[model samples]
Target: MKKQTHTVLKNVFGYENFRPLQEEIINRTIDGKDSFVLMPTGGGKSICFQIPALVFDGITIVVSPLISLMKDQVQALKSNGIKADFFNSSISPQEENEVINRAIKGDLQLLYLSPEKLISVRNTWLKQLNIKLVAIDEAHCVSMWGHDFRPEYTQLKVFRNSLPQVPFMALTATADKSARKDIEEQLGLTNSKLFISSFDRKNLSIEVRGQVQKKKKLQEIVNFIERRKNESGIIYCLSRKNTEEVTSYLKAEGHSVAFYHAGMNHEEREKTQTDFINDDTKIIVATIAFGMGIDKSNVRFVIHYNLPKNLEGYYQEIGRAGRDGLPSETLLYYNMRDFVLYSQFADGGANSVMQKEKLNRMLQFAEAKSCRRKILLSYFGEHLTDNCGNCDVCENPPKDFEGTILTQKALSGIARMGQTDGITMLINVLRGSNNADIHTKQYFNLKTYGIGKDVSFFDWRDYVIQMANQGLIEIMYAESSALKITPIGWEVLKGDKTIRLTVPTSPSDKKKQQKVAKITTGNDTNKDLFTELKKIRYAISKEEKVPAYIIFNDKSLKLMASQLPVTENEFLAISGVGMNKMEKYGEEFMQVIRKFKSVSKPRKTPTTDKTFILYKEGLSATEIAEKRSLSITTIFSHLSQLYSEGKEVELEKYVTKEIVDKVRIAFNKLDRKVELKPIYEKLNEEVSYGEIRLSVTLILKNE
Candidate 1:
């Protein structure tokens, strides 16, 4: 079973190994057992069932919620030489009948349908076909506790009961523990194995910029887009009007961009999505209606122009970037206004309490002073032991001070106001604002009311937020977002316990925060070569009538440019390269590589070139190090550098796969830096530094 599954994975899907728990999940499903998989987006959830579908004699039916997702998945599958098709409203009745006939005739290996389509066809045409496995994509939609619940998914319980003989696998990218339990209950899975993959996407750097003026914020966004320069990105807005406004602003700023929202007609939305997916359009400013189940792997960044309603949606949306496992960026611009606006929207919902709580969590994440990734993962019930150095907080941590007096004053104001008002009112009271409400309530007469008049309203707001974050106060969302003092607040108010808070960063102070870090695509791949490969991919996409990623993602193209794979066997060794792809697209890509190599300059360092020569002359890196009287660490560094420069240095000769894996694991735990000292320390000094350097290079190459 393992060999067959591996063969399918390699020869068909072009992957060398199963991601964590993917093999286990596949084996469980093949054994006629139910399983639930909670993996992050771009975490290879589709492969879990795609492999089983290929291995099984009967067709595997996939229940997806989006027609775009089905079409994309089916196209990708067909490109890999897998027999797959979809039945959805997007297709004509004749086309649907053809798909149905193919399934009934045992010609199709996998079939995808929407939940509504599945429910409609289950008793009639679905039962006539042989079914081996039923995989539900976006399984979170089935649970009311989930962020994006759909009523059609609740009817799937009937389908589950009827297909008792078939194994069931429910998959989602973002589900908390409550949602997980709800899904299992809804699916009627008995003793099912549940797998929750790590929710951390280390390649994406998270940043939240707040309290900037609207004009400055728009300029900052323009500056951000300018820095990326031709990379694809998504700027998520909260409303259709915002999408249009952002789209027009970017267009006026001379960018190739478009807008997408629920308000757009079907054809308009489809064309916009297609243009973005095909790379004809570079930036997409859209509402949350975009990017669900989008398989575009080359998106380099994601920006949130407004605050998202919940952490799950925000995480899932940001997960859209860097899907190819290359370094990417996520920038969020939010303020107190976004919070209040979302709070008002959440106020009248059926799940108002839950909605407000989730919104509060989202606001906390935006206003957080610690690692943003840690907060996001913890919300999804995945805890990280160490601070992720990939967020703005980790990079530009705010300064802390003894803020006991400040916290006490703020808490005192809230308490004196009877804790009846929210953050705005509390700030007003603290800053001694002469607003009509304050004058009507005669709040200027109170002791706490004019005591903090020296502090600016913005500064007061920041201090209050810092206090809330520190648990010195709480916001009662159910009661019009009233401010309430916590047990810790009393201690701070009475000076029994001292509290430290981050100094409020004014707009001018934030301007001095370090400039955005340089975005790393990959290790020194030839940019010219990458560009040429994209051109070829775009041409092929136009010819083949599929998204460019279906031909080859940017990661695969980067590897091609780095490795300069000129032979069929060498091409197959590239990540995302399989026998089918190698046979189909090998000659064209290899020709490009060959031409570039022939014309490209060597651009070599003398010392590294000398080491490369000796290593190429059948000398191991260690042997060369000993022969040249150089340190092994220096020799390994030379080889890694040469590898990054497109030279084939057999890394396996210097380090065993197990050693490389251990070093890679340790390297991931730390911030992914080129320095080996941190990784060496993280591995407890068990692995040699030379091996760590070589292993890090290999990991980046494969990524």
Candidate 2:
């Protein structure tokens, strides 16, 4: 099994190492045992099934919910030179049939199909195939208690009944106690291997900040990205409107960006996806609809402009970064509004018991403070011996005050009330305060009215959430109110481990790095030119559904105004221009160029000037390279973006073939070898003294 697995790993996947449990999981599966793996998103979950699938005696049919995810997996597998294919709605029937045929003939190692399709008669393609393993991915989706519960997942149980002989591996990134039970039940894996990887992504530093107004928060994000410019990353927003707004916010700040959401047409979403994969877009401001199949590994950061629905979603979303085993930042902009809004999504369902449990768990995750990594890991039944010295808490170490007395009083107040009111009413009761309404409720409780005078209601509420986050308190939330204390909280009140608690600062008070949301101006003609170009770009942008600058970046705009390309051909010849973009967007820009030429103000060729392509103020050479597919040497050959008139320098010494042609253009007819001043003056024309020096160098260097 080792030799076969190693062969597949190297010859097919080309990976020299197996991520943690991957080799063991594969070896177990290849030995023909049922396995259930719970690996976090960045844990190389694919390899668990993929390795076993490749080396197994027959086909391994992987059941997944996301079509895009299947495509991503298939593409990655194919790139590794492994035989993998997907049959989904996106594929033609003929193609699907071919893939099915290949599976039946045992020519394929892994076949990914949607759960909805796998149960269909036509896709009973699996019926005739000798399937070695049935791997159910996102297995928690089968449980109503899971964050992304899909009803179709329940059918996996029925499918399992049909093929009682086949081994099943149920896999998911998330599941608490309830969800874990549901996965085992739904998949009918009563006696399967349960391999749960710790849900701790120590490499990912999770920092949640809020109460910095949305615009300022966006600017903060911009500042963060600016510091990390040129790195790959994602920024998630809650709504399509927010996605567009955030994308605009970032692009207005001059970031290379793309936006994605369900509101977009399939084509638009596909285009954004393609652009991201092809490296045309460095940052994607998107809703949760994106990242289903995103396999790009070098994503150095993932920022959430809005809170996600649950910890599972948050975990998966943030997990998209640092996949390449590098340090990446996960910035979550959290607020109460997000929590309340997302609760509505999990609001109504037939499975009330499971739904209530799942929602409360998510709430706990958001409000957590002490060893956030430990709590997240413990959810998957993995214990951490020492604090993960990576998450926000371990880095800063929150202030731990004794909240034992406070907890007992809060619990006593709830007992006296005889029923559950929300946190607000409960806090009010414990503080021993009386409004007209409070007096109506028996003029105060017997034992605990205002008993909590030592603690503010706000601070006490913070203690409740922190206790809940650490599993010390539990919320008996449902259609009916039942606020019950958990066993841990009871033990603390009964003189246990002293209730030593480290409370997190109010998310509202945490200092977010501030940013100037509004773009300031330099109060110059270039600034005016930049403004005008942005307007023109905005108009074109509405039609293209792209950010304004993707068409003509700020540096490109500066290049156009400073170079003042007077003709259509010259406009096309400007850097970052191709024939298609030039024809469509160039007329309005041409007017600006013509307008600038008429004023006859001496134009300062920007660092991106065709004759000065090697140096620039605003853009790096990589960005220029990405914008235009031309190589570094070719771009350097077209330079005039760097030369100045009064600066005295010898052209022969600094000059290479890279700039020789452009250098030859600036020499004057008299060729007197004066300073570079003559050349800068005649730059708009064909000849200047600087140009003659190149001809002199061609002879002087040779002699």
Candidate 3:
């Protein structure tokens, strides 16, 4: 069964092996057991069930939350030669009937439907099919505590109960302990095998910027985008108005940008999403309504124009980027106003208390002085013993010094004032301000009143916020936003535990201190070759009417550029190339490589001493093509002729003895025709045409 799973992984999914926990989940599902998967976005959750869907004899029903997600996954699966379909309102009645009929006839392996459709139409068509498994995606949405709850998800239990014999798998990317428990209960899974993969996306470099003025913040975002020009990214705004404003600003600055919000018509929103997915737009300025289950894998960055409502939403949003496992970035700009607005909105909801608590945790994350990843994972019940060195805080940690006296002054002021005043009042009193409020309370006479007078107002505010984030002090939002000292704060005030606070830099100073690192394509990757490969991929995407990533992700193209595979076997060894893709695209891509190599530079003579010198200097064929202004095949030709002439050239070094033997045997095995293309095809195109040509020269010369 494991060998069969590996075979499916390679031949169908184009992957060499399963990602962590994927094989186990697939095996469990194939063995007719229920599973609860809590993996992160882009964590290959789809494969966990999709593989089982293929292995199962009966059709697998997948309950997806969003129509876009279903469509994207179905298209991707179809491209990989899997028979899949989706039944949703987005399709016409006739089309839906066609899909239903196909599923009933056992023509489809996987059928994706929304929870609403599954419950509303279960009796109409779903009951007629032989359903082997029921997989619920976005299972977190079933819980009221989830960040993106849907009432329709609550009705899924009825649909599951009707099909009690089928194994059920509930999967979500951003569920916490509470949401996980609720999902299992709501889905009615009994004694299910639980799988919780790590939430860490190491490719994402998380950074948070203290809110600057509007113009400065926009400029900072623009600067960040400019450094990663022509890459796909998302800019999440807190409101539709901000989305429009940011979209206009970026458009005026000559960026390929668009805006999306729930206020837009369905067609308009759909167009925006399609354009972004099709690579027609480079940036999307959107409210939280967008990006629920977007599957675009090449998004290089996700920028939060304002702080999110909670850590779950923030994590899910950032997870959209770097899905291809390439290095990406996430930048968040946060201020107290965002928190206040979020709190006010939460007040109107039934789950106000939980929402406010989640909001505060998000604020703590944004204002954290230590490693941001630690605070984030800790919320999801994962502990990281070491700091993730990828985040901004980890890369440029603030200098900490003994601030025991500073914290004591703030804590003392709060205590003396009965802890009823907010951060502003405490800061004003500690700074010894002659404000009207302070004088009205006659707080100037207090000993702790002027204790922190040496600290500036902004510095005092920053320090207090830091204290709240560090849990030494708690902010009572329900009590008119007052600050109360915690047990830790009491210890600090009593000189029991020393407090070390990071030195606060003013907003202007911090903005000036911003540093942008240069983004490189990869150390060993050939940029020129990579660009050429991208051109081929884009051309194929255009011809096939699919997204470029559906053809091959950037990671696969990078490997191709690095490895310079010119044969079918070599191409298969590159990641993401399955037998289907190899058969469909192998010849075309190899043609491009052969053309690039053969005519990259026309040879004036058959052999050249300079070529050997450059080769001996360890310059690869591609590198020598650029340095000597010769085609890669021309260089190979010169080396091959030199070897034939019994010169100092080492034939085995240029082409491995193993490959040389295979190519010679392949060429000699074919009779009456010694052509490179025929020999290439006969050998399954595993050996490059260039290698075949070189081998033929040597064979004829030796004979």
TM-score of every model? Answer: 0.80, 0.59, 0.79
The total of clashing pairs for model 2 equals 18
Q: Indicate the TM-score of model 2.
A: 0.59
lDDT of 1 by residue, 378-482 (tens): 887779989988777877778998888888888888888898988878778777788999989888898988788888776777788788888888877658778
Give the 10-residue window scoring lowest on summed lDDT in candidate 1. Answer: 507-516
| Best-to-worst ranking by TM-score | 1, 3, 2
lDDT of 2 by residue, 632-656 (tens): 3223223322222322223344345
Report the lDDT tens digits of candidate 3 across residue range 94-132.
Answer: 998899889989999999998878988888877789999
TM value for model 3: 0.79
Compared with the true structure, all predictions reach lDDT values of 0.85, 0.67, 0.82
Instruction: Flag regions of model 2 displaced more than 4 Å.
Output: 122-124, 344-357, 400-703
Q: Which candidate is the best by lDDT?
A: 1
- Candidate 3, residue 15: the lDDT equals 81
